[model samples]
Target chain A: MVNDNILGIIAGILTSLAMLPQLLKVLKEKNVDDLSPLMLITLILGLSLWVWYGVFKRELPIIYSNAFAVLVNLSLLSCYFLYRKSG
Target chain B: MVNDNILGIIAGILTSLAMLPQLLKVLKEKNVDDLSPLMLITLILGLSLWVWYGVFKRELPIIYSNAFAVLVNLSLLSCYFLYRKSG
Candidate 1:
């Protein structure tokens, strides 16, 4: 049987890394028309909560994943505005 | 101090609901030119793992949030293909 935390770690890593492709795309294309600001805002908010929850639960995987997610989402959010303004 | 599970629940709800506007926009606009198929695919995979993690942990909030998220992401994925094909 698979360990649950191991699964969680894998899930967390994938989920966090999932932002890379989109971020890179946006950076390369310099377009944010398809990315919704509201979605980014809500995602950041949700990710913040996840970080806090992980902290409270003493779950390192959860904390690490969400913490990194917050950074990636923040980068995307900033890029959205930056690219939109410049483009 | 705030309850961790409460935070988790709220995070889950927001994260799950975060997909709504994008999905709605895609459905109404019938255009997915900006959406990345690779991102959608990875998101679905990550969400699936999260669902399994929730199940192993027996965390209802995680399960519910991720399960709903899976459906929403799947819808987005299908819409990506459908609209891509149609448009």
Candidate 2:
């Protein structure tokens, strides 16, 4: 059986880490130009739901990771918007 | 109060949708070159955890979203590895 505490911690770190490639790609390429609006909009909604689910469950890992994901998504979205506006 | 069923459905759609940006960006840019292995590794772990969390809560949204997210992550990771190998 998996240790619940360790699993939660590992899950948190990994989930957050998953954002890195997108973050790095956006940062390195500076080309959020092709990112879709529907995608971002949907993701934000999803993240919002995850956050709500976390709160309902009182699970810190879900709460923290999804919250952080919202920020990452927002940041990426903002960059995408900026790219569009500038272009 | 929000309808839990509706919320779960919305959450599932949103979470899955969230992966679109990354998918599109990777697709368009064809540059998973800079993606980090540690990040991919961590994300898989997190996604797995989220899936478990979903199972525990009996939440369809979490299950579907995280499952989809895992595929998205794996696809991206495979591309990154290919990029790394090629260059």
Candidate 3:
């Protein structure tokens, strides 16, 4: 049980922070042509759902990780639009 | 409880399949220059751990969803390598 909790925590941390690199890359390059807006939109929807699911289940790990993911993806999405518009 | 379960299922489906559009985009365009390999790697690692966490908890939804996510990310990672090498 303890091991499972640790695993969940680690997994949550990794997944939540996974997009940091991509966000940094886009910020550095200011290019969004190859990145798919549909993907980001779908992911954001999914992450939001996960947050709601977590709320229902009272799963803090799921809630926190996915909430953070939502924020990151939202930032990425905004960057996508911001950069795409300028070009 | 049933509503919560349903929410979890839907969330699982959405999050697990979120990368499909991105995968299709990569296949059609053969361009992953904007995608970050580190992000994919981190996501894959996280998904793998989610699978293990699910197994430990005997939660089928978590296991299946994360397993599928791992597959998607792995394919994305392979494409990243395949295209990055050629270009």
By summed lDDT, the worst window of 10 consecutive residues in model 1 chain B runs over B78-87
Docking class of 1: medium
Q: Model 1: what TM-score?
A: 0.89
Give candidate 2 misplaced runs (Cα > 4 Å).
A1-6, A24-29, A83-85, B21-31, B34-37, B81-87
RMSD of each: 2.0, 3.2, 2.3
Residue-level lDDT of model 1, residues A13-77, one tens digit each, is 77777768878888899888777888889988998998888888787878888889888889988
Give the best candidate by TM-score: 1
- Considering only N, C-alpha and C atoms within 3 Å, which residue pairs clash in candidate 3? none
The TM-score each candidate achieves on chain A is: 0.87, 0.86, 0.88
| Candidate 2: docking tier | medium
* Prediction 1 global C-alpha lDDT: 0.84
Q: What share of the true interface contacts does candidate 1 keep?
A: 0.79
At residue A79, candidate 3 shows an lDDT of 91
Model 3: fraction of native contacts: 0.86
TM-score against truth, every candidate = 0.89, 0.75, 0.85
Rank candidates by DockQ, best first: 1, 3, 2
Candidate with better TM-score, 2 vs 3: 3
Estimate the TM-score for candidate 3.
0.85
